[model samples]
Target: MLPVAAQQNLPVATAQTQNIKRIPLQRFEVPGTAYETVIGIAEIGPNVSIGRHTHPGPESGYVIEGGFELLVEGEPPRMLKAGESYKISPHTIHDAKTGADGAKVIATYVVEKGQPLAAAVK
Candidate 1:
């Protein structure tokens, strides 16, 4: 058996840093409707592009770190840095690319029941 002092000196397990971390914050179902509100955070890696995608509902997000280049259908691309925010309409095609130092964002969405949070745009 290991001594108590020896056990106390052992390395502790810790969560490793990752390129991206999606943390769900909250979810609320609309009363008597097929809709729900979801909130979460997205941590992106440096120089990463999330790729073109669409949501089944409206989405709003605020930049928390570094910056992002956002491209949405029918509009010119825009750069959003920390403390900045954006809103995306339902079914609007868009893509988010992170800057050199990477980025973190807090996002919220009002979506339909059973639909995916995001769908890739072909």
Candidate 2:
């Protein structure tokens, strides 16, 4: 395990740092069919409606700059604010939209090797 000091000094990694480009949500996906973690900063648009999708594995995220409303299948949508964190389990259906002023969220996705980061579902 990394020492507490080392962990504290570590910087947050983003999708760009992982070599993934900032594509539109509609075009979001792991390029080249290679499954690997891609951490990125996302600016959640206000009142944005994300189509239904499923994560191939787990997706962990935190609100960094703004607030949002998150909805996971079988649960009611909930509001999340800055500094809040949540995790989407493997194969879980979910979607999210920004709050009134929009939000910036840092997301880290742990996907299965060779699987797409998100698979569109209905």
Candidate 3:
């Protein structure tokens, strides 16, 4: 895992309103180790997808550019436009897709130490 300082030293979104904003990134702690955090860029790319996956803990994300829709178990597809955000609890099965024009978002993942980025479901 990357060090927190190293991650912080890198350049990232810093705006606080409108087009850009700097928000608190969430981190998940393991039973007996340091926490893990998912740092996201404002506008990643168009049609970007992370595939169906699982989280060891909880995850949260906010749209920053364009828009996208999400489908989680027991829920309907939710359209999240720029400035919108959502959170997923640990072990939730889900997948994400970028908007037609592409979308950018800031996502914070709380995962246990040594957890896979995501566990693909069959």
* TM-scores, all models, native as reference: 0.82, 0.68, 0.66
Best by TM-score: 1
Task: For candidate 1, write residues 1-122 as lDDT tens digits.
Answer: 01121222112122212456667677889899999888878777787777677778898999988998999989999999999999999989888778789888988888887666776665
By lDDT rank, best first, the candidates go 1, 2, 3
lDDT of 1 at 76: 95
The 0-to-1 C-alpha lDDT of every candidate, in the order given, reads 0.74, 0.61, 0.60
Tens-place lDDT per residue, model 2, 26-109, is 223467864556566666455555556677778888887768788899988988899999988988887776656777777777
The TM-score, computed over Cα atoms with residue i paired to residue i, of candidate 2 is 0.68
The Cα error of candidate 3 at residue 46, in Å, is 3.7
Stretches > 4 Å off in candidate 3: 1-34, 42-49
Evaluated at residue 26, the lDDT of candidate 1 is 79
Residue pairs with backbone atoms closer than 3 Å in model 1 (clashes): none
Candidate 2 Cα errors over 4 Å, as ranges? 1-35
Clash totals for all candidate models:
0, 3, 4
